[model samples]
Target: MFAFYDLETTGTSPAFDQPLQFAAILTDNDLNEAERVDIRCRLAPHILPAPWALAVTGISPDQLVDPDLPSWFEFSHQISDLIKRWAPATWAGYNTLAFDEEFLRQSFYQNLHPNLYQTQFANNDRLDLMKVIYAVRDREPDALKWPLDDLGRESFKLDRLAPENGFANHDAHDALGDVEATIHIASVIRKHAPAVWDQCLLNRDKHEVDRLLQSGHPVCLIERFGAAQPRSYFGVFAGTNPQNNNSVAFLDLDLCDASIIDANDQDLAKAVAASPKLIRTIAINKAPNVFPVANPRSAHGSLAQLVSAHPEFHQRVGQALANRYADKEPAQHVEQLIYDRFYNAGDKRVLEDFEVADWRDRAQIVAQLDDLRLKQLGMRLIFSNAPEFAPKKYRSAASAAIRDRWLTKEPSTPWTTKAIVEKQLHEIVCGEVLNMDQICALQDFYHARISEIDI
Candidate 1:
């Protein structure tokens, strides 16, 4: 199963930002649609969207506040239910793992759902079209006609790429429109480069990762940046991730050399952790765009030569990583655990229960759970699912806890007050920065709420 999805949010900060609209197209392995979901939620009472974000989405304050629209909490439940119904599917979209996945995780966390398991459990995994594009560009530039931005650099933005490739992306920023575009792009990739697509598609299975690491060959490791273009590195299997058995470690062969094997335990540990000094590891759940090195770059030649000549290189690298993370505490943060490959039997049972439980019963059951980790998880669920049902003090404390975790203070109170509305209205008309389309959208927004507010 593959669920191609996209989201339009209040801003870029996943912790502080909230999704205003959610959309997905559920499909089988062949790319035939199974179902489609598109939802728009009333802006959360506490969220104050960035002006540029609002302008891009063209979602007015009036539309967000309309009684006809579902509340954020209600909409979150719908999103969660739909996602659960399509569980264990590969979640693919343009830049989704880096952006939309975070929004979805926070939504589940804030809505009392077991946010952790949904993306990782049942062999579920994720793929990024953006990374795929970069990999193809590097390996076979002629495989697909890559689009370029105004500056003549490769442009992977969905809106631009869709039209360039004959995919219809109506209303670029609209959640459903973007989902359609993503699915179209993915379909084309599957058609033109099935081998590359299959290779890059991540698998949550630990054995699969182990097999890759044990292969003793360099693989293409790809990473994409939000601001910069994608970069690819040649990496070789080094060892098992010390923290997660399900994850295999890799040494950036391009950055390492023969001198590594002579290093002591302490020196090797320090070297593994240091950037540009050699080794890097990622979990199966958070795997990147990786493929077999079919056409190695010139820079990869040196590492390839070294590995071909040195039989003991990997063994030494493995020992170094083990020494580095030996006594370190396990990561406690959700972000850190996204890449976690290992989950004990008890953890698996908890996740299974979470999946099978009736949505209404989850909060209460979690609240009464005894395990410290389970207790912490349940508290988040209770606070997100039904704050009114929780003790008032508990609710306040929960909110404070999330705020501290996000490292954000609440924005100014009464965000929709007359002054703010008037200021937005003025920005629509008199502001020098906004383009005509944005100004027009903002003006229409102001006109829509003329009867409700003085602004």
Candidate 2:
């Protein structure tokens, strides 16, 4: 089974911004649709919608605060339920692993959903069609018609790519429309490049990827760096990260020599961190574009065999991986702390219960939570959903904080503040090619939003 999904969000920061829309199509193994979901939610009161984002998506002011739509909390529950209902399937989307997956994880985390990794847990896997497209472009260039951007460069944007390949009436940015187009593209891949499709499916399982990488054989790794075209390298697994098994180091045989095994600790660490890297760090869980090298280079094969025999070298590489990020600062925001630690089993159960509990009982449930982050998030949810049920002090403080957050003029703040939105609206009006009516409406929306902040 495959679940092709897409999201239309207020902004790009998965930590601060929230999803305003989520659309998905559930398909069988052959990519035939089984069911679909299109959901939208009213904006969280603390969020100031990015004016450019609103303009780009064509989401009107009325939609942001729709009285008929569910709160973001309810919207999270609905999507979480859908994920649970459609378990044991490959969750896929165009560029989802890079963008939508983080948003989904953050959404679930902020809304007190018990499992932040719902797509990866419970027999579920993930596939990013965009990543698959990169692999197909490298291995099966004749499989699909590739589109080019205005600069005549190869374009992978869904809006252009789908139409280039014969998906008529592509809806560009709308969530459901993008989902349908993604499904069409997937169908094309399966039909024209069955081998590439099958390889992608096999790589979706991290364990399978781990096994292949550890098999002491040369593999072809397809990757794109910055604006460069995708390139293939003959690599062998150097080591796995001691701190995170999902991150594995692959040595590009074409770039580094076998003598790397004899390097000292400091030298090995430097080599791992070098620019035009001697080692490529891959997120095994992100469905890395790695495949069996069909025609292995004799020299590369010899290097792989030499590196495979040196177990001590692999250990040193793992040590290098562990120390790579040891000096980085810890994240300060609650949103950034989603991966700081996993929820305890006790708190997880309480959260599960909190979801189904009545509003009146939710405050008590929040108090029962052992995790401080959950308690804070749960209290905020209660204050937002049913303020009268919360204690007066918390209600007052939360309201004041919301006001301060909106009215804050700190230029370095991560979220979309009122000041930021005002500047963005000014830029859009002056620079964008919109008519007078549209400009007036945007200004009206901005003022209306500001008036509600109560600062």
Candidate 3:
């Protein structure tokens, strides 16, 4: 059983923030509801709403006095009791783990003793609904990608599927209101994305992602709008290095088998795929964004091509093109270009190349991007709904091109940025570096994207 939580707080951090109100939805499995609760405490002077938080949650300073619960101490006791009794192994909320959990913790710490709520929850199972949703939506359709608030009047109903369903038109920003909403979303997920649900089950068991990948099971990589394009990059696990065997191999190092010279985050790997257990063995690591995962599956061997050719784009204006003119016929390029757009894989500026005399021919190229292709490609490009905050899937065919030039041991020019970035990212994610040949392939990759990017 997973207890879904959402907290409305006075501020933002667990160490510094305080939870003014709270909500929760207990589910046995799938969307099956087990329990529901909503509580609001007396609003304190210092706990007054911050303007930005108020506007986002639609909760206000005055509402705190309205939804009176049994008592502060009593309810705190009640919360502890509920958690101990149900003891849900996983608790998830949209951005709640980071924002809600911290604030709730700090609030409890300030109000209660060191023992009451803090001790009971420090070991409690936790999940981040926002992270999961973002992951799923990254592969979703463009229309269905954004949250309801972002869409504003779109068909997606935030309230209908949320606290309204559990608390019956109760306050939205209150802790309990948000918790109910979180559970509702889980129900929606059971219906909309079964694969993610399955992954959740694995998560409950604390399954390792590397093991899942090595299982050789078909990973959907499905995107929104029913578009799917699949490719497999199996780690060649042969030779003397038993550690790296069955893992991604890089230029000279076997990521799975390579020694962790200096690293911090284990899961956010670099060029190869190795267990975080291995990463913990080394010390050269930094934060997640700085490290970036480097899985063979994550990177493109062809990245170096794009970086070298980026400057050469000016020269291609007159030279005979290859992809577009395949024996003077256009077939796969159009399909490929459309596939790259939703993923943000293709370069937007490249559309200028489609500027030919015949508009009909250009229109035909546009047709190849049909909805299905976009969904598949979008899934590959986006790993999470919040791409900037979270790691993305596709490296924009452009990044792969850049990677090739950077790894040549030459002083980095504009061309080397991609490879350096790729090497760093690959190390962060997979805990390995790029292969020499793969690094060299970036130059060609540059030309390839130039040919296919845009219309």
Candidate 4:
């Protein structure tokens, strides 16, 4: 059995406030409501929600000031009784995994009924519908209409969807009225969209199960483009995050929520190790792309510095840089120049693969990077891949370049590469297939010249 639930709160913190109103819809197989409940209550000292909460929910303080105030504690008891009687496998709400369950648990704790959090009652029995829609369904922006009070978004806005679906929400702050709206929408979706229904149920324990199946499990492999961008949470998607959050990592590991488990949680560590997607935050530029030229470049600081240090490859790097000036060229000329200057210092394979214009732009960046590298000041990173390659800061020029190359939405040339790199072109391509974002990463990777940091 599954329960579709919604709660309106007097405040954001469940630890501080009780539900002003709530709705729960019980369903078995189809839209046939095995059971449904909607409850509202007047405010009291125990549930003295802050003034801001009342204003946000649009529920009047006068509404709860009545002498015949409803007892929410008793109402919560009714809910516990229903759960005991029904023994539902799961209950779902939009963002319920993150927001609702925490609020409910806090309410239970404050009311001296802490065990209400456990499913059967045990821990982690609630499903989050918001995650379900994102993982399985296409996240096209315009799919939804603008909501009354807020901008309509695909990920976490229940208000955005409710109005379009016919159960328009009047207040974000009222728990019972919110419930009435929640249950109505859940009922409508269960009757109409079974795919989203099943997806909501499955997301209670797993993330991206359906989308993974649909795409044959394509993981977003990362490569950083510039130094200013830091390792973002998006790094979690590919593997263990690069952010200095808990300060623990192994030779291999998986990535999960830092807030949910301890750093020493070996079980969680093992789980990460066993996964195929080795999530790791990658730097785009040589160093963090700290703007304003105050910092030294990390990837390829300067040709003069590099040449002065190595001295032997000076002629070759100069030649590669000069190739940018060449009007028309053979693939060999490009390869030879890359071999001379950028071969050992950074991954300059992209220079050999990009169109003339991009190649020229890269040469300029490379020259700039070499200057930074010469100074040995690295760029700063801001973002990490949490199942997606989100950089700390996306350099507009580089991002546009990447988007154009992979999305192919703009005019571009079929940039040719040297012979050795293209060998076995027809072989079945291994490594997980690239996502739209990952494809951009590949383009960024080829173009970016960065020295691998050994940490």
TM-score of 1: 0.72
TM-scores, all candidates, are 0.72, 0.97, 0.41, 0.41
lDDT of 3 by residue, 1-455 (tens): 67777776644434323455567777775657788877655543222233334334544434544545343433444556666677634666766545766555444333322232332354455566654554455443331233344435322334543543342564555566556666666666666776655564454322243343223321222111212221112232111122322122112212332222222223223322333221111100100000112443332223322222332321221121111223543334222232122323242222222222133343333334434443332332232122342233344543443334333455533222334434443453353233444333433333343334222
Error of 1 at 277 (Å): 5.5
Per-residue CA lDDT of model 2 for 151-180, tens digit only, reads 999988899999999999988789999999
Off by over 4 Å in 3: 44-75, 111-124, 140-177, 205-455
Residue 375 lDDT, candidate 4, scale 0-100: 14
> Model 2, clash count?
0
Error of 3 at 391 (Å): 52
Number of the predicted model whose lDDT against the real structure is largest: 2
Candidate 2: C-alpha lDDT: 0.89
lDDT of 1 at 267: 68
Indicate the TM-score of model 3: 0.41
As a TM-score, model 2 comes out at 0.97
TM-score of 4: 0.41
Alpha-carbon RMSD of each model = 6.3, 1.4, 26.6, 28.0
Please identify model 2 stretches exceeding 4 Å from their true place: none
Clashes of 1: 0
